[model samples]
Target chain A: MRLWRWIVCLMPGLLSAGEWSGYAELQGRYFPQDAAYENQSDHLISLAFQPEYYQRWDKGNQSLLVVPFFRWDSEDKERTHADIRELIWTYAGNRWEAQAGIGKVFWGVTEALHLVDTINQTDLVENPDGEQKLGQPLIKLSLERDWGILDFYTLIGFRERTFPGEEGRLRSHPPVDQDHAEYESDREERHLDFALRWSHYIGDWDIGLAHFNGTSRDPLFIPRISNRGEIKLMPYYEQMRQTSLDLQATKGDWLWKLEAIHRSIDSGSYNAATGGFEYTLVGIADTDMDLGLLGEYLYDDRGDEATTPFQNDIFVGFRLTANDVDGSELLAGVIKDMDESSWMFNLEASRRIGSDWKTSAQIRLWSDIAEQDPLYSMRRDDYAELTLTRFF
Target chain B: MKLSLILATLLLTPAVTLAMTAEERGLEIAKEVDSRDTGFHDFKASMTMLLKNRHGEESLRDMRNQTLEVEGDGDKTLVVFDEPRDVKGTALLSFSHKVGDDDQWLYLPALKRVKRIASRNKSGPFMGSEFAYEDISSQEVEKYTYKFIEESEHDGIASYLVERYPVDPNSGYTRQQMWVDKARYIPIKIDYYDRKNVLLKTLVFRGYQQYLDQYWRADEMFMENHQTGKSTLLTWKQYDFRSGLTDADFNKNSLKRAR
Candidate 1:
């Protein structure tokens, strides 16, 4: 706490002049069904604070941004964490650009799954949706041409993915023992990585192609007996190579998206793809609300051997936008297994309460889990959550 | 004898314009308007939007706008939000075209992501205000067909009333009536008619200002909805032109870095 205060106090002087902005959120979760594992809680509460500082100079050609995040969970020790989300300095030239420091980058265009998004590790303890990510240290360079934009990155350090603790509401059958993690590379977390991407747009289509060679962001877990003779999941990281393609086309009220990836490990290789479309009916029933229907198909060649549950699945969703002063929106989706009877359903709604405050609610339900399914452990973890945020 | 006839014909063209069809006269007037606004190059401004409901409760939104003129095409524009703290640092980028749908992308600061949005919602409200997407986009001469209704007076100034029909079938309004100032060839007022051919809204332009001694821009735009009893007022300031903005400043990368 003293260190945070010192940095906040000295930032204004060290940076000359900068602006501060961010938010504080309070979240509460309640589980309706019984816990799927022992030592789990049925209710949980958390508070998170993220503050950002930004400054620009040299006619907006150069700038620096800093974002630090901290959270406290009432039930899980692993969920109580703090980290820097972004601390990057950028320089924009006429045709070339450079950036250095820890930052976050997202690269994919799909609704059901993110097959091509592998720049940063997921911060899963924060949310089950896998949308939150940890910051990565890197140096990047970009060139802008008439044809497209090309980017090169040299990733410096690696960050491990976070999982729910034993006392957390959502967890695998056997809790993960992060302290006893193993890595295939001798250098372990110090493994260096590299990536390159080219993106362009033509008429109504936007396209991106990328390649990454380094430590895989997704880890394979192996069950092991710990020192106390208790069974725990141990994560193993392996080095791999991946090439991906993402495409999106916007035509009238319809948006078509696709993401495909081919990854090769030391032993074998696999392929995965997700493709979908979202069509909106504007001004439905003489009102200003928009109703959008989304459908996506997910496929993985590994089938039963895949670590993910989306080997052969389909997702259908609805998105409603009120377009009112409060910026109201709702999204509900269902993901069903094609081979099994397992399914997952989720609903999320949010709206601004006033000028600075916003409220959101989410519900997740799982049903009819098969023993071979990856999500069988979570069949009893149905939960509902509410969050209120105040922004500065 | 040939030279004398050519001279006579040239002299009669200006006065005998009444002999031309209404469509021809309207197209000529539109051409004049477009010609007068040719060389702006680029511009930047700050705008404040005031939205009021039927109950007279008001809300405010503040944003900054930048525009770059494209030769033989429509303009490129970027709008970044500043006020209403929750939406700060959010931005929208658009590439308008003359004959097809405009391409648009929205930047969400919280997620640090840029999403390509469908631009077919031309009649939807912008920022919960009475202004629709089409009302704020770049006006190209090819987007509409016009007919001259009459030459009359508006607010003590000489004006020409022209009726224009949208070329795109997806447009919400069937037609719009515009009053062009005689001296400046700028729009002074516009009445939007719904698909049912009924007057739905009226927009009045006030506080006209000229920049670079050639471009005329309105400082205030007031729009009122007749059936809903709602209104929106837009006030603009700090109009800077020729700011040297290039294509590099309006791309996906730029949208992510917008502050």
Candidate 2:
């Protein structure tokens, strides 16, 4: 409480010196069905605040940005957490830029899945979409030339992915025991990582090629019997190397995107790809609204044996943009398993309330999940969430 | 004396016919407008857009724009949003071309991703304003076929009226009528006709200022839709030219760094 008071007092003075902006959000989630796990709440409320401070010096070539995020969840203790999303310093030169400290970088072009965006760890407790990320400590250098833009990264400290608690609504029957985590590398969590990427655009085609060697961000779970006569799933992180390619071509009203990755581990190697296209019809029905039709196919060579559930799946989505003063938008998508009859449906809608406020609604549902499917554990955890955010 | 006068008249007629045609004259005027504003290497400006609905309700949007001039091609532009707090750090990068479609990319700050978007929707409203994407994009002489209509006076200023037809099939307008300031070679007013050859909108530019003693820019632009009764008022401020901006400042990396 004292620390919070001190921060509140210092915020005004800091704003007078630099540029400051952020958002505070109130979120409510409703689960109309019963929880899949024991002790899980049917309804929950959460609050989050993210504040960002930025300052530029040396003729806008050098700058510092700091963002801190905090969230409080009513029922899920693991969901209540704090993180420094970004605290980075950047310097730009004639044809090169260097950045250091904690940051986030995204590298994929597909919509359904992000196969090549491996820079940051996923904050899974935040959302099921996997769009939220935890900042990663890194030192990055980028060089721009006639050929292309090349970036080199040295990732230092590593952060493990967050999972829901036992009492969390969206959890497996047997919760993961993060305390008993194992690592394939001798350095464990301290293992350093390196990555490089080259990206460029020619005509309407944009291409990116990247490589990463590091401790895998995705962990495999191993069921173990505890000494207390309890069964728990222990996470095991392996060392892996990945090569990925992302490509996009924009032609008239059509945008084509493709992302593919080949990851190699001590055990073996596997390949996965997600490719899709979005075709838009502008000024539909004699109005200002635009409709976009999207279709993407997700494939994993390992098929049902893959760790992720996206093996042999097809995703189809529709996006509507009102192009109105309120910036109204909506997206509905469904992912269907080709091997099984499992399906996951998602709907997201958002609109600006006023100049400084916004409201968004999201609904996620899983239906007819097969017992052997990885998503079968929480098939009954279908829920809808609404969030209202105020920015300052 | 009558024979000599006839000979002289015949010779003068040929000279007048060879001087220039209407299409050539219009093209020359368009070139003049483009050339007069050529030497401004780069510029930065803050802009505000006021959108008025048919019911008289208004919404405001603020953004900052930076443009870099390319010698042979169209200009490179970067627009960063500021007022819409939800999209505060979002930025758009465009590389306008003299022919074909322009290349555009949008950067989302929350996801830290740059997405290449289709630029074929030139007729769609820009930021839900009455202005379309083509209405505000960089104008190049090659995009339209021109014909000089008449020399007239608009708002007490001597101007040249020109009718230009769009060359692109995707353009929403069949043709546009423009009134170019005779002295400054800058467009003072424009009337847009829809694909069906109906009057769609009228745009008026005001508050012209000279920069570098060679370039003229409008501080305010008003666009009104004739059928919808909705309007958009665009006001620009802090126009700084020759700010030492380079090509590197208009790339994908630059889009992410725009704040």
Candidate 3:
């Protein structure tokens, strides 16, 4: 009953619009490995529910948008969680408008590896791993003119960490004494990040550009320390600077997309008790580059997501789509016993069923080019997965 | 062997006959609707377009246009913009055939060039409305497989509910359900779908009038979105047909010559 009440409160925005709308989905998967231990197969089931509510007043000049979401994974001990995905209050006047509160701000168009879907789950790039380490409270502002649109935002009071001691204890290992010591005194960290984005359309092309700077939650730490000498501190002091460029073009049935991203990171210095080595990870000491391409062929059909029939018309007969999904080739030159370069490729093809359901087969390959070199050879693995998705 | 052959023929005859009857009825209705659409030689109408976003805010614009064309089989239409000078003198030519594919061209005075609009994009929104390029294109009986669903009344007019499935794979709409007036065969209502077979939108027609005795035109059309709380209203005026339009006027080279 307590869980139900919490879910209801978290979803006030969903019913506020006085309309009832929601969707539920379930997915299952199987894995196989060459080695018995590595090849051990497992099954996972997950459910995601979203409810949306909205109200518009003053002839749309002022409005409220709310969406609350919930999820449960059978594989994760049947743990259930709820979150307010979007809660935004908007005010629009003539040429300028502003929206504040917690909501998703998607900045990039790259489908597979979005540099800007950074609202939540910074560590889990493709799937949610039950960790709420991502997402920050932010304030957003925008200005719209006849020519284009400009947007700005700042995120504050951000902290996420993982302690090594708790994980070690969970695995029946010794807990870190330093982590337990830190937990006795409540230690809190804060961060502030800012970004500017611009978007405009010219003829058949839509273009976007953005730049952002801020501290990224330490990817290697946990935020809380347990009383049992478990240290949960996400490595902080690491900062990142990022820039992106995007372009999309549509002609006839063909839609083309191209995007590029450049990121520089400064990994802060930390004390290593195990090795008794004091290390300072420089900021912007390493650079990462990403390039992506996407293409889709749209067929003519009634523009609805439902009530369309299964037909083999030219537009609906068959469709082919391919993306470099997450083709990020990372190059780290001689840094802390880590010098390697890796790349990934993914491709898919699907057949349209009416307008709501589609079945697709996908193949993925991952490889490390410097695997043979002693300086950089710890990265080489390939996996493939096929999925049939239905959209409404 | 002889007995089995005879039995096989006897069993297949009824099933084939039933299938043919349904298809034949659908084709007949399509032809009837197409024929009734004939006769407007030329037309001009003043219109106002209203757009309402999800927030319930409304944006209104005025539009005036003139259309000249014929009906049935192969027909050519010339559309001229009168208001919104930015789009004024922009001429749209549609060459529709009874079978096979249709051709379209747009002449932009600013660009001083005639551009061919591809038919593959016929499923997309037309002028950002629920109506797709395929919906506005000429409807030839052979291009679809139709099924008569039922009989109903709309705005006091007796109508037949018909389902039309596109034969062209490139069409955006997999299937469309239409309400055609019994007397005039003009589509009074239509439901559209996307490739995923989801209900995307609906269009309602009102205020029907006869032009040049044989042509029936709907003065008002309202399109509403199912997912997004958006709607578009189009009011057409001055619909004309057959102002001595010839093949020369529809030629790619003649796009600039169109006045």
Candidate 4:
């Protein structure tokens, strides 16, 4: 922690031409369904702010970045929190580059599920799309060549996943006991993780292979009896070894993507895959607009016993871009289970208002959720959200 | 292919004996333009884009652009956005080809992933501005077939009018007419026609400056959408040519590090 303080103290003078940029957002959510948790409200408001500073020295290709984010919820106590999203130093050489400190890295190509993207801990409280992640502390080096890009990582200070508070809509029936979460690795939260990836592009195809060792980002749960006679889910993180592959083939207006992973945890070894394609129709109806159609298949080897939500399911979505000066766009999708005919529908629309302002509307719904589903408790949390963001 | 045909025609009908059609003369003018601006190698510049609605509402964006000249093929370009906090640190890498489809990719900093954009989207607006991907692309002579329209005076300046049709089937414009300055041989103004043969937009180039005593560039470009009552103004800054850039600097991996 001393090193973090030292970097932050000196971050303001990293370069002469550095810049500061970020955004502040205000959101209002409305739930039409009955309250899924006690004392939960149908209407809620949230405020978030993120501040960032970046500096890049032209000499030796050195750079520094610092980003701190915080969220404040009106009702949920646990939902309000603060985090340092990024604080990294980077240096680029003629052939190799190195980066150290807290940052984020992503890997995967599929849309429905991210099978191989597990570098950073999931920031589950951020949104329903599962796209936001917390900063991870690590040291990384990469070598660039004609063959491919080879990268090595030394990960440290593992972060635990965050969940919605008990008073939030997306919470599980029995609150997840994060404070008492246990770890299978003897090193606990200080576990030292290691990872590597080799990526290359050949003609129209981009492929990557990766491997990771140490603690798994996802946790396994056990039902424990509390002192109040209430059942709570005890979160447990196990030592894990994961190997994965991601690929994308771009040809004309069609893009085919695939992500597959095989991992071994405390219970056993499992395999999962997500494959999909995106086809776009440009200038639809003689208007300067684009419509993208997406289809994907997600499968888990655990079948009915799988803890993951996506198992033998189909995901279909469409992305419409108005291509106007305001950058208006709409994305809607549905995930349907093959066996039970259960489903979840989502819609997200956003557009720029002026130079520095943006507005968005979001919707989430569930229907006919079966008991066999891993997240069946969230069926009653159907809600919609509206947000306005100001950029600087 | 057009070059070979021009050569064959030149051999059959002697240039000294005349009999050069407008097509041949138009090809000659294009060749001249290419000849004069051939060896820039690579260049980088800062750009400011201003978007204005018909009501005079304005918005601005800051960006950095770099381009590398390929020997026998089309140019490679990279654009990194620095302003507008929502899109800050977003970079676009484009490899323009002489024939068929060009390759393009977008790097989203927040997502930390590089996505290959559909080439068919080249005709769509770029970043919600009046300039489409095709409009901003490095205009190589091979991408268009040209016909000499007439010699005329445009904007009180002597210019040669020419009509060109995009070779790419996915281009949004059915045809375009350009007025090239007689003195500089650089395009000074352009008129675009939509797919339905309706006038869609007009682009004007101003503040022409020469660099390295060999290359001509415009410091300001304004594009107006006639049907939508929208317009965009792009001001070029810090135009530095031949900065020792290579193909290695324009690859997909470099996009993530562009910031």
Candidate 5:
């Protein structure tokens, strides 16, 4: 089935008047865990086939790009699936432009928090116990100008609640299992966000700033609600208020970024809920800074009971460029969880295989130092996994 | 016979000594080359790249077969790629304002769709090569600040060397040094620099052919990466200007209609 799609994509360029382009990657990995858990590893294969067609209008004064894409992943525990990555239509004139589509809307600068780093079609938040949560659908719009860009988006039917053990189910579970049917089902509540991003180059620096509000589809959550309230049955829809500020600076090969997020939630429900405003700060530094070191620090002032111990984290890493190639890069880093006092070390290497092909491999090992606490005892299951991937 | 020979030599010496300064002559030659090539055109080219790793492993790859049609003071270009099965039929349409901004579009085959390539990505490498998207685009004289370096002889040909600095902040090249043939006013070589003003790559041109009597084109061009040890060679088979092609030929409708 996959092979046929690729052939069909190539046919337009070969047999008709359209063009086609695509890329593919295959990767295998092995995992070794300490005595606490069984060692397990899996191989992954991912492919993206994209083909676009352009139709010129009005004496070559304007044109439109109709690009659709299909992707597949072998390691998807749910099932092997294919869907569009970017389906956007653009109308461009001399000075004005408009686009409408469902594509990856990259709005942030931090690599881990909001930089659109995840390659998986679905958004997954990996918990300490290795569980994953999926993402939601979004409708995006944008207007660009010579000075900067103005963008707005709203995820109309935000549904993150999945069945407890039905890994392959795409539909919602019974109402008995959900506290709020409107929020849990894929038909109620709207996650709206708007941002104004400005980018300017001054001397050798590429500076950018952005301001946004709303809940992020990813797991980089900021705390909301103060510790002063003692109520129950919190409204899930009211927990979605968040404001984010992001700043990034790049000079030469170095990059520095800082993000501060504030959230206000109606936390009057649940035993651990404190209802006020919470703030989190995160900072990231990359090899472009100095000596090929990449590091990050994050802090949340929402109290130890409300925020996870790993919420306060500091890590440093190094990136080495291959001597023979321009884009090949190797990155290694060790992160220390300030709250749990645990540590994680990771190494990744990537190279451009061909004009459109990319290959990469990564290995990660984690350990917990605060084993005295029962909650942190799982840290003893330190493990490592090596993954090899190819991108088409 | 000796007296006649001395007189002839003396006369030619003064004539040679009346030449312009190196800086003045270099600028004049650079302008001449730019003027001769300023027009809407169509081109088809193929490229091959040889890539080597740090441990001496080598691989040969066919990069791309590309066709470009330009219009409107060269501010807009319709580019098509026709090799490497994956992107064999991909087309890119770029529109640039004379004074303000530029927009780009890419048509993919699988989805039967067209996507807008974000403009902010102009600084990113093109297909992971040392060259950025902007590097492959047509360059306007107003985009750079030029200074005459010197007059030098290269490969037995007298050339004028000129230094050029990018006027746009988003440009990947901080500076470039171009060697122009003195008589033909055609660029034969160029050295590209990074943001730090360090030499990053060198491009060499050969197989020059005269077109339209006044225009000169290089049939072969090679870009060598000093840092990566990789090189790409481009060979142009056909280049036609004012071939009665119009804006209608470069539109999105023509993309699916391209051969």
Candidate 6:
């Protein structure tokens, strides 16, 4: 393929003029509960590699970037995959800039729910947290002016969200069928998506307004009978429109943040919002450590039967930063459903090992999740994970 | 009675007229330092940071900084991390003021979000460096109250020793002692004491270079934390002044586009 030739020809140039950098990580997760499936294992190991290449010219006014990521999980077949994280060429003028290629975009302010972030497809197989993403191809333009900055996006080919395999520990039972995917759009994945945002800062407040219209990245799974006479959840992508507002106010040690959105899908239209504040206590106990207290309220209009979670929920958490040489920090939080006793608790900690190495660990727990809850399937998937990474 | 009254008046008047209050001398020196650093307009420079741990392990980070001087107030600055693949695309925008709360924003590349960091007390370290957030900011004359300590000599350079107290209640340090060079009106060394009045760190500036025939910049700055046995060294290069940078170049949207 011509792509292979391009890769071969670009190798030498990338080593000399362009910068090549990446990281490799080995991770392991252990579960306290017994294996839930025949092929499931209590212990799992995964190795991941991410390599990036970047080249810039004209005093950094123009550039090209390429980043490829791969992960190989020993226990779960679906977890082993490869993706192009970013391969964008960018240009910047005096007052405007443009980029065309595959990349990722994120928008949100809340810590618990990220109600506004919807650019890239979620790589659920990589982690249940959904912070990782598969890059999307798009053309982006941004204009900077006196009052604010305006950004425009033209999204092209869409990437479908990935799911954990049957053997994966954090997955729904019986698995969701990926091959029988259907889309409301006649063109399926070829459907175009568009988005725009205007952001500004006034005094101590930073605000952003954004809108998106496209094939919904979040699919609706319908229980269907397959050709093999087995029941499976069929993935259905629908057309949807969403508008969001994100706001944050920083005064002294307090950060007040809010993110709200209104989404309209063929199923119906709904409004959801999450707002919170974080108060930080710096130099606590006469040391350089900082402790941040966070509280947020989540609301949704659809109520109990709503497909979206976080209907009448509250999140409380704390983030502790050591301010050490390694940049060590720990964050712990719990989101409690007000309608029920269901709660999801998570803990994350990371620190540097040496000059080029870093280590991190995470723990997640779900308790009293009702059958109607969106996270009901993951109720028993409590896990503790550890990863050591090396960068070049 | 008349003789005694005249004697007392003469003694008191001489003492009052001869003795300069520490506050007066302190303000005079601070004014001099500010005067020498004025009218820079803007600047761009590259820096290499060396971080060392208690065990003597070392790490390096490369970065570029651009600062636009705002008249009548503080300066607007931007720092872009260039090395260390993890933080390459990371940029920090700061709008510093002499009084009141300064504004700061951090752009996280991996998350693709510009987070407005809480800037109540800037006592936190700047990216795990020995320099705290407050230390990296441009020093304005109004940020601290100063008192002349004494004159001292370091490395054979005549210097004026002064002690400054932070005006904000949120400062992590109780006081700081600075040694300013007599010839250049520049701080050559400083000692920071913690809230407990304990010696915390000492910073030294070396390799002073003058640019634009009027501006003075240091080629290297070293900060040593006495309590933690850690240190950070910043080596600056390519000092370019009057780069035609404007206020629009330091906005939040340009944070993501920073190279």
lDDT of 6 by residue, B1-259 (tens): 9999999999898687458799878877988999999999999999898999899988788899999999989999999987655567799999999898888889998778889988876788877788898887989989899999888898899999989999988877899999999999999999999988999999999999999898899999999999989999999999999998987689876787785
Write the number of the candidate with greater lDDT, choosing between 1 and 4.
1
The prediction achieving the highest TM-score against the true structure is: 1
| Candidate 6 Cα outliers beyond 4 Å, as residue runs | A1-16, B1-21, B53-55, B82-85, B150-152
Q: Indicate the residue-level lDDT of A279 in model 3.
A: 17
- Positional deviation of residue B14's Cα in model 1 after best superposition, in angstroms: 3.6
* lDDT score, candidate 3, position B16: 73
Query: What DockQ does each listed candidate score?
Result: 0.75, 0.79, 0.05, 0.62, 0.09, 0.51
- What residue pairs clash in candidate 6, if any at all? A252-B120
Q: Give per-model TM-scores.
A: 0.96, 0.95, 0.44, 0.93, 0.58, 0.92
Error of 3 at A295 (Å): 7.3
lDDT by residue for model 3 (B1-259), tens: 9999999999998887567655576666778887676555555556666767788766454544444454556556555553332244467777666665565667764334344443454554554444556776666677788888777887788998888898888776688888888877789999987667888789998888876777777889998879676788888865544544443334433343333
lDDT of 2 at A371: 93
Question: Model 3, range A1-392, lDDT digits (tens) per residue?
Answer: 99999467445544445433334445443333231122222444556665656566554455566667676655432134566665666665445567676655544442333333344333221232122333346787776654667778787554343221221111111222332221111223355677788876564555778777765443423356556554434343346566766665545344455555555564322111000111111112111111222222222122221111111111111222111111112211111112235333444444433223434444434345343332121122233334443433
Deviation from truth (RMSD, Å), model 5: 11.1
* Segments of candidate 2 deviating more than 4 angstroms: A1-16, B1-20
Candidate 3 vs candidate 6: the DockQ winner is 6
Best by DockQ: 2
After superposing candidate 3, which stretches have Cα over 4 Å from the reference? A1-17, A34-41, A77-81, A116-136, A159-189, A217-237, A251-256, A262-264, A267-392, B1-120, B123-132, B136-259
lDDT of 2 by residue, A111-130 (tens): 99999999899999999888
* Tens digit per residue, CA lDDT, model 4, B28-110: 77877887899999999999989888999887878999999998888999999976657888999988888867778889998
Cα lDDT over the full model 5: 0.49
Q: Which candidate number would show the highest lDDT if scored against the true structure?
A: 2
What's the ranking of the predictions by TM-score, best on top? Answer: 1, 2, 4, 6, 5, 3
The candidate, 1 or 3, that scores higher on DockQ is 1
Which lDDT tens digits does candidate 6 get at residues A1-392?
99999678545545558877878999999888876555777878999999888897666677788999999998998999999999997877788888899988888888998889988999989988889999999999999887788989999978888998778888775678867789999999999999999988898999999999998988988888878876778889999999999999987889999999999999989999999999999878877799999999999998996776699999999999998767789999999999987999999999877557889999999899987888877777899999999988
Assign candidate 1 its CAPRI class. medium
Q: Model 6's lDDT to the true fold?
A: 0.88
Q: Residue pairs in steric clash, candidate 4?
A: none
Question: Model 6, A60: alpha-carbon shift in Å?
Answer: 0.8
